[model samples]
Target chain A: MPVTKMIEPILPVEKLTYLENFGHSLRAASYLYKPSSADEIFDVFKVAKQNHLTVTLRGAGRSYNDAALNGAGIIMDLTRMNKILDWNPETGMITVEPGVTLEKLWQHVLPDGWWPPVVSGTMTTTLGGCLGMNIHGKNNYRMGPIGEHVQEFTALLPTGAVMTCSPEKNGDLFYSMISGMGMLGVFTSITLKMKRVYSGLLRVKAYPVSNLHNHLNEIFLAAPDHDYTVGWLDATAGGSGMGRGQIHAAKYLHEGEDPDPQKTLRVEYQTLPATMFGFFPKASIHYFMTPFFNNPGVKLVNTAKYIAGLRKGEHLQSHAAFHFLLDYVPNWELGYGKNGLIQYQSFLPKETAEATWNEILTISQKKGMPSYLGVTKRHRPDKFLLSHAVDGFSLALDFKITIGSRDKMYAMLQDFDRIVLQAGGRFYFAKNSETSSETALQFLGEETVKRFKALKHRTDPDNLLESNLYRRVFGS
Target chain B: MPSTNRNSATPLKPGKCAIIVGSAKGLGGALARKLAREGFVLGLVDRNSELLVQLCAEINAGNVGQAFPYVQDVTSYEEVPALFQKILVDLGGLDTFIYVAGILLPTTPTTYDFEKDRLMISVNALGALAWFNVVAPVFQALHSGHIVGISSVAGDRGRVGNPGYNSSKAALTTYLEALRNRLSRYGVHVLTVKPGFMDTDMLKSSPRTFWVVSPEQAAEDVYKALRQRRQTIYTLGRWGWIMFIIRHVPSVIFRRLSL
Candidate 1:
């Protein structure tokens, strides 16, 4: 007798652990499916619909919190669906699958004298994730969020219908999906307009400032002329040196001045060894600096970094090297130990940015929860329904989570949220891990939240698309 | 083919040209499509003529680059040189040659069948060598080109699951290493790609599949490695460390473990 073989579906449901955006917290999903194509994703939605289970789409799992995690249902991991669908060099238009990372996109296009119009600090994030968050780069003040570069996209709705959306077609859905945080649907493909660059080199200049006022002034003055501008703040700097930092400004070098042609066109992605940060051992830093989660130790380290920045006045850098400085030290977050870290970013209007930032720094100093890392960038408003941008500035802070300071950290963040709300500021959902739904409602205005909720109800009527972040922030 | 300089600011006129064996399906087919999108004229060769013609039609439909199909069995070692000559002549030139044809036999050391073992050796080991014998000399004459061979991580160490398949890959790996050693002085690059478990037809029946990557992911990794001119790479890259640890395990302890 011969045995009869049974063939199973390519993607099978399996139990998996889900990590929050910052990797500080984790949960388990009842079922997880890693689909390699849009059709497979459609099957996943079908299964979710049939089983009456919610579905959450995850891409590269880089959202600092619960944006891509679903505690009670299924997770569709889209990392494997990465593919460059098409590229039209003459029009400077490129089409890519949702799973393609920014690093991959840049590498593919840079050699052809083209580049993405907007890119966030980390290059590992997926293009789909960037669109979901509507991420802003250092050049946000000049270029706006990544959504502005998007020409059109094909999205798979929860009802298993695929629709092509653009600014001119399906305009309502297009607006909602840009910053809808994946509540709208899953994007299968996106076509973006790319910017032309003569070379990958950037002419960089660093200006050190003493306080928040000086930092803002320098950024304001530098924004008009520079293509990219950002500030690195020393959160532990107190008293006379409050909010002190360095403002780094950069622009692409002209064709003739780009030093090495081979390097400028075909620059290889460079990575550091796990133990090496520049020449120093990162493991030694983690071991020796474990006890420095305190105010004074953090202050000393920040001061050292500030002095180092001051010494590096002017230099030429690869765009990747300049934009992805945080990734240079591999597993640097391990320095925070097992508890992980939390990142909180708030966007305030230009009129109230300086005052709100001063109060926020003062609050952090009083609470003695000095952020280990801080960055500030200018921005302008966009048309996305859940847009986080304002004609102002955003301050992002990273706090190391420790056993003793966890509660204090949450309380401090709550206080910060209150201050931000009082100043008419909004929060970035991509970086938030612990914001309450009430706070989220206030951060996004009541009317805007209502409109987004109504759109979600219409698009995902059965509410099949769900995530932990969605539950916490939208009360769904 | 066009003489495209990747480093130049000027765009490629007709783009680079590539010859990919076993491109009718699976990883090879995926790579062919990707290279086509990257503006590469393609020479797609496979034993399955039906799939080969269909794939060529699909790639040609895009009109990004022209796709030429050749039906030839890799195991027919003597026909490889002639096939290569035909592809080069049809495509005008070749800048990249990728060999992705290989067979996996279900033969353990104890239950091995002679025919399966022989077929595995012929397709997985000799077939790659046959292609290399023809392509390497042309690349050396041209003084500029890249050759990529898709081996497997299973070659890193011999195990009980399938000794014949593992040994064939081990042979391919060493052959590619020797080619790399000899070709570097001539500016001809040889890259050996050792992929972990990829979700391809070969692994459809395997029960112990873990950390399996999609074929598209494998193709993407291969393209990136070729761009960087890496000597060797592990697709889904973590497999490099996994194989490193597996290869360094003490023999006495390794014998007792089930792989």
Candidate 2:
């Protein structure tokens, strides 16, 4: 789609994906810009701001769970503004456009023996998205979210004004913007602090946990000290004193563990087509595409797969493979079919961990609804305006929308809110759907919300960049 | 129960208690839909508020029977018991406990990307336990209940991708096996699932390897397996023999094999 041709139908498209912050997935209407100059990037946002359309800035669509989605207006996809503006090899710091992917950043820095300090679960997500989300990596307990790694950056507010801010300069905007859930503005570029790397090989340790309690103990034990650690739970197993089902811990490896550090480190992962990839989230792909029962197909492949698994483990990386991983699994969302999907992530105080997990499970057991990727992790408190992290544990889950049950899901969520509020937990701004005013009231309180309201009034008074989240929480 | 409409309008089947851990969406979402159709009340738990809200809206329209959603970290052991009690107090009992809450980490080799492994271990391993830690006592107190777990067939053995996932699943299956053994004495049904591939977001977002089943189909299969009290069943069925061999393969050979 040529930029000029694609720009015509910007408003009428019905399938827009609204992100959490000011951005949206208006790919259908928004023209893909391949700007040869930064001036052009600014021009895109300027035109949208002047046209009275909602404007959002986006990097690689990696701001998970709609943090990067906005539908009421134009989305300025910064993916094209990826240029390395500056680099300090000695300081291990680099400044680049908001569109530069962490993977792309590594390509340049890794050769010089450096690496980005923080990263998300996957590599395909963009550096700008990382900043905008202020993502927390596996080593967060030790390093904090991605925001702590940056020196400064540029964000363009809805007024078409670009501001360069950092901890020392425009600190309020800096704090509010990084993990601001993309509410403040769009990031044009960032100067991120990178970590020095050695062998680039990651030496790992896996612990088998019997149950949730043990997992938490191990997680926190590793949290204050370990360089990198995370824990996964087997939500399916329910029994007394059941431990060892968990595999929890990892640390970067040193030299000679892998025969060739350079080769292993640099190997790029190219995603295979859906035909070869088994875990794609498409309903048709999983349901109709298979000749046998879905479970049976998975089982049938297990024996042959067991052998294949060992063959791949021998390979290690001096540098992590990023684009190759995503490239191999292109457009995997087709598997979800047309109904689309939803991902939910939230946190609760560590003290309430036991009551919360049990309550959810007990409810799930009664409901007979089982989520696919049940994940659990710990987090330290974060100061980002509306960042999801608190001084407790967090969990993220995936869900698929069906033909006629969205309402049921909504009702269930309301009660869940009561329990979370009772536990003194708040919804992650990046991941919530419809938090009741009552629940929102509890978290934000009338006074805090009033203050934020005052701030929002001062900054985006027109509510120029509106979103589903904004309407649900702020009633903007 | 006899007159309950397990269809589009009144999606739940009455009398069946369901605990949907990751019931926020996809297979879990579809499972909730099916269970609701069967007249079963749902206890939906998810990290995504949007989906949870959407779910509540879908079920609460026209003043249908009520359901409560608990925003929780299923992996937190202490929270599990109270959750069980609340569900019992609110909905009155525990008939089924399904751990569906999960986050998809990109399926990559564990050695190179330790984060992926750590995540797989945590979500698949500890997250699964979040349900068990809470429910083990509830079912034991009740003296009889069903524990239906969504264990992936990937856990059967290591594959070319995501050994972390595979290991987590395998460990989950093993733990479930042990749990089933312990629970069987008290008349509890422990049914473990090895779904090959389901048309869920995780599958959609990742590279496609298997022709997946719709969440409805997967949910239907799971429901049947739970009702029949099958100790272990392959979701797609085709993956059964493969996993059977993988499960029994010698440790040396297994370790030598590529995941």
TM-score: which candidate is best? 1
- State the weakest 10-residue window (summed lDDT) of model 2 chain B: B1-10
- Complex DockQ per candidate: 0.01, 0.01
Write the residue-wise lDDT of candidate 2 on A1-476 in tens digits. 11211112222323232233211211112222334345775575555455444445566665433334342245566777778999898989899987788767877776565778887656667777777667886676677888887899987665557889998998777877786545566677789888876545565455555566776677778676556666554443445522213434555555555455565444242122344455654333444533422223433443333334323122232335321332333443333444444455557888887667667655643554433334667788776665567778776644444545456655666667777878877676555544645676677568766655565555555545443344345552
* Backbone N/Cα/C clashes per model: 4, 190
Residue-level lDDT of model 1, residues A80-166, one tens digit each, is: 979999998788899999999998998888877788999987888999999998988999999999999999999988877888999
Q: What residue runs in model 1 are displaced by over 4 Å at the alpha carbon?
A: A1-13, A26-30, A269-294, B1-259
Query: For residue B116, what is the lDDT in candidate 2?
Result: 70
List candidate 2 segments past 4 Å from native.
A1-46, A239-245, A254-260, A267-337, A434-441, A444-453, A458-461, B1-259
Candidate 2: CAPRI quality band: incorrect
What are the lDDT figures for the candidates, one per model? 0.80, 0.61
lDDT of 1 by residue, B1-259 (tens): 1111111100112246789988999999999999988878888999999999999899889956668899889877767765665565345457899999988967544686777777888888988888887778666655668999999998888898888788899999999999999989989899999999899999975768889999999999999999999999998799999999999999999888878
